[model samples]
Target: MDHKAAKRRKLTDKSLPNVILQNPDFAEDSQMYQSLLEMERKLDWTITRKRMEIQDTLSRNPSTTRTLRIFVSHTVSGQSWQAGTESDNLTHSETGENIPAWQLKIEGRLLELPQRGKDKGPPRKFSTFIKRMMVEFDRDTNVYPENNIVEWPRATGHHNPPLDGFTVRRTGDVPTHIRIVMYLDHYPEQYRLNPDLSSVLGIKEESLLGVVQALWNYIKIQGLQDKADRRLVRSDERLRAIFGVETIPFQKLPEYVKRLLSPPDPILLHYSFDPSLPVVEPERPTAWDVEIKMEDAALKNRMGVMLHTNKETSVALAKMDEEIALLAQSLHNSHLKRTFLQSFADDPAKFIQTWLESQSRDLESVLGAGASEGLTLRQEELRRSEFFRLPWVEEAVSVQEGLRLASKGM
Candidate 1:
């Protein structure tokens, strides 16, 4: 209901794929480019975390009794070997060598660990079976909502006692290995196989098991039982298991090179002036022109007298005109820059707003025909766009604060 909350939800939702697809030119500007880069980086993080989890799991079963182990030659040779050496007790089992940062060993041939077919989750009957269990969940007595689907089938043979324990379905451990859909917070279509993958996999009874798409879809619809904090606590109760949150001390380079470290958020790039440090200001372009115009008659007369000849006066006039034009253009440029900064405090956010606004404008233009009011309304709407709605807060913080934020969905 609130403007800010609505904006936040709209921007973060992954289900808005249609919205993303509709605007092919979503982020063509400098700001949008930066936003894309930052979004890519975030997705990279999700990928990195997944890879690390897989690596850790694989690391446990040295010879791969459980899951297959496929070693990347470079990862093992360089860091794994060196890392194995430092901590004598942490030596490799077979080689008995100390593990360095990430060193590994060479072999005659690359050993590929074969993937075991997913353990079929024992089939269970639908909700109709649950009705026979005589489990009475009378919603009139409680706040719990009633199940609307008349065809809702009870999960039969779900006797495995989650009675004392909680069911933990990890995004990683899911059988179909679905990827996280950006913005939508939903599974990709690949995992949502048509007419139920059960039919295609030749799985009779169409019972959702072994990371069934149906279960995932249900979980998404019902939402996860655990809160964010609950998830971390349950998943990694032992903090000592792995070292995470790499801490790199902030080492400032000459201000000029700071450009290389651009704001992690693309939007931040839109509003920053030439770096505050004088050395970092970009070199002046040869194309820049300077012009000065004399508004006073006396000033014009003095220039005429000084020049003496008409030819000289004409030449001076032309130069003055050029100089004046340049100065005005530079001023306008400054204003535009200021406007951009004031709007979003970053290029990416501004770019997104501009794009959305542009689309709205285009639509208004088509609908309004020759009417000018639509254009005016569009201009007003642009002024009140998300660019001005959301504030760009700084993410950088002290180590403790950073860790706290990271833990608390920073």
Candidate 2:
């Protein structure tokens, strides 16, 4: 077949590189360069997918908030509080004798209020917002009380097994007041935006990341991005009134947004517990519902597993990349060899003449005689076909022919 027909057939062939290399046209460096570009595009797509997965995992529940009902109640021995049932006949651990004790029951549960939206399923039995609860007891006496700080670790049944209730017992006089502190895990502090900023953001209180994301959404919806430079934002009238500027840089958006935020209002609860009154009467435990942000443990754990890189996998990938690079280099060298042989195979006479001219130029440049009189004389001799029919050529041919004949006879 003609070279052009063979080249067209090779281009349309649906076969591996090894099979395609059987055709001369497929062995061009241009084909190899195109293959490399395709490989790079695939690699870029893979990396982009991985990055998107990470971003989706991180932003899954950026500001997950829940209402937790904190119940605090006080009761003496032999009396039951509304918090939960407790053993009144508790004996001292060492003495093994019945002792008068004052019990403070501190419990937390997930509250499903009608005002708040309905949950997808039954509310969780416990609060996941609280990592642990710290209860401090202060007495009127000068002596420091033992077990002053009672820690309740399992505040939520989401990840950990649920506990019935957390109780603090004191053998001596009952204190008039107690302090309860809740510690949270993976919870970002919320801020209350000023009136001007809140009007633009549409939310009075939000986490810093949430606020920034909302502002970005607003900018995108309004199409305030500068056409000439995307890094600069063209402030609309509302934004201008809020930021007090005509334009804002994308990077400085967070800084300006932060200035309009103040600390969120603290939750305060006041309850007067009387031990003498019955639990069924007006002396029941006081419960306060407080909304707080918390991380989704299940989603976070899944994301963590996805993001975690195995050392063995990384090593294997690195080895594979090295092998690919070596193979690509080998393929490139093979392509050069194939092109060289194909050129000679297509037209032997012309290939030889072209190759000789290239070699003569290289030799002249290497010998530093390209512009000398000797190079001009050599070029003049090379232009004639009879230059190879000189006396030296005849003598060399005779010597080679004698050597071959003598070897065959021997």
Q: Per-residue lDDT tens digits of candidate 2, residues 237-267?
A: 9988888999999999889989999876544
Q: Judging by lDDT against the true structure, name the best candidate.
A: 2
Counting clashing residue pairs in each candidate, in order, gives: 38, 0
Candidate 2 at 121: error in angstroms? Answer: 21
Residue 252, candidate 1: alpha-carbon lDDT: 17
* RMSD of candidates 1 onward, in order: 41.4, 14.5
TM-score of model 2 vs. true structure? 0.45
Report the lDDT of model 1 for residue 71: 15
